[model samples]
Target: MPRYARSERQALADLFQTLGPDAPTLNDGWTTRDLAAHLVLRERRPDAAGGIALPPLRGYAERVRLRIAARPWPSLVDQVRRPPAWSPVSNPLTDELANTMEFFVHHEDVRRGRPDWLPRDLPAGLHRALWKRATALARVMLRRFPADVLIQAPEYGELSAGRGGEPVRVVGPPGELALFLTGRQRAARVQVDGPALLADRLRAARLGI
Candidate 1:
């Protein structure tokens, strides 16, 4: 997971650089300025009882980039050595994991928005780890849907389909599946194997971030 986070962060930073002026387009209607502001807001606002001020976006990204380039090995080690501070928003583990997932998912988001901004490359191990983590997170998110919908992914085999009867089929690669469930990827990534109407309804229900 530590390695995965490191790789994911690197991918995100690379995407940011590649996207350049088009970075904000990644979040559907949001502009690059909006995306930058969103990240800055997330970083500055503490989820815990007491908030710790985060550096500005420009400074934050510079720090992260320098940390990655100069001492990537030590950065991963440091993350393991130091626990993430608590946030008032959610569980630290969940939040941290989500942040990592956000990097990968948003990378796709930006790439999809700007076809010219392709990823240079992705580590094989990082992709596999993301697949595992995304599958687990998808299962958790699927639980909120009605019982009749059967959400299955060949990549992860049969997952807990929640309740029965209201069948809504969702299938795709782990990253696409995660983005689809999170309402970021609206494409036909999730196949409604059962009833299309149910899938439509599920799609209409906006899942919170």
Candidate 2:
């Protein structure tokens, strides 16, 4: 079974619990409260504001707490099924999968500075799924980066630029590779071996995140 939903939720909840009083910074200067609000709003009003909605920052923390308390396990699957109530926004499976991947990745984001926040265990199945999603997203994002570079991580097989500089090698288990590419975790289980310069460039870009 695809355990992305449950595992992702567990990870996020654990991260929140671990973070406690200190608010961690997320992408684009958003605080932990902002990140939590964004995640909750996205799940609640997926269609708000062209698939993007911004709630008031003042009460966001409490809102997030309440929202998290109210949500049930099957909410994500239901959200995936229906059209986002917000117009001009669509939730493709790719987007849904990507969101699931983001949840897992961002869990690490909040925990990065706090050592005690690290997850004790990550579900193997969910990790594999995220890796696959990361591979696909990496291919899409590679166009923005140099083609000469290659990423070799055991979690995500060997990804290399193909002819005309398109990413052609997206071979690997989805979860591990996805986490490595995104910078959530180091490529410990896997190794990137090819074009040192390219590898450095890829690392700099942080495509997996």
Candidate 3:
């Protein structure tokens, strides 16, 4: 099987290096440098990683992130490309589970941020992998949403999500769907079918893992 995580890691690192520190990313307030710094801290700083999940710890995490972001851009990108082996999320055993989607999403965040961007043709297996995770993530992020969310990736599979209401079918390939539901609705390419008002509302609603 192809190693999606590492490929995405390298791809994102290369893009960050190519774009330089000031380039815009789909991440609302982040630039290429900010994104690279986050990736480095995510794997290298265990103590601060929890801040990503816990509201109170966010202050500490931001402090560390800012400190890291101030480093030379090349160094930050290198750290993202080659995480130390001892890091909890970088070792082979946990890498796929920890970083596959993490890197994939962030990679697209940079890719789609550019005006001339085009979606890449992802591998079939990787599409399946992304769709499987997207299903699980949808259950979490859209659990309270006001519509019955149907995620459709034509060649892969389909699944339902959200609290039931007017059924909303979100159509796209797996990778795009993953991006859409993961708080990148603006950057993702997808078709929403349902009541127009409800569909519009759905698009405006919060999504992502």
Clashes of each: 15, 14, 2
Worst 10 residues of 3 by lDDT: 200-209
| RMSD each, Å | 8.6, 7.5, 1.1
Best by lDDT: 3
Tell me how far the alpha carbon of residue 14 in candidate 3 is from the true structure, in angstroms, after superposition: 1.1
Tell me how far the alpha carbon of residue 198 in candidate 2 is from the true structure, in angstroms, after superposition. 3.2
lDDT (Cα, 0-100) at 179 in candidate 1:
67
* Candidate 2 weakest lDDT stretch, 10 residues: 162-171
* TM-score against native, each model: 0.62, 0.58, 0.96
Give the alpha-carbon lDDT of every model: 0.52, 0.51, 0.89
Off by over 4 Å in 2: 25-28, 47-99, 115-121, 149-156, 162-176, 183-196, 206-209
Q: Point out the higher-scoring one by TM-score: 2 or 3.
A: 3
Which digits, one per residue and each the tens of the lDDT, describe model 1 over residues 86-174? 53322355544546666666556666666555433545555455566665665666666775545454544546545565556666655
Best-first order by TM-score = 3, 1, 2
List the candidate 1 regions with Cα displacement exceeding 4 Å: 22-24, 47-98, 115-124
Number of the top candidate by TM-score?
3
Residue range 138-209, candidate 2, lDDT tens digits = 666664665643544355355544234533222334554565566543432334444666555555565532
Candidate 3 — which residues are off by over 4 angstroms? Answer: none
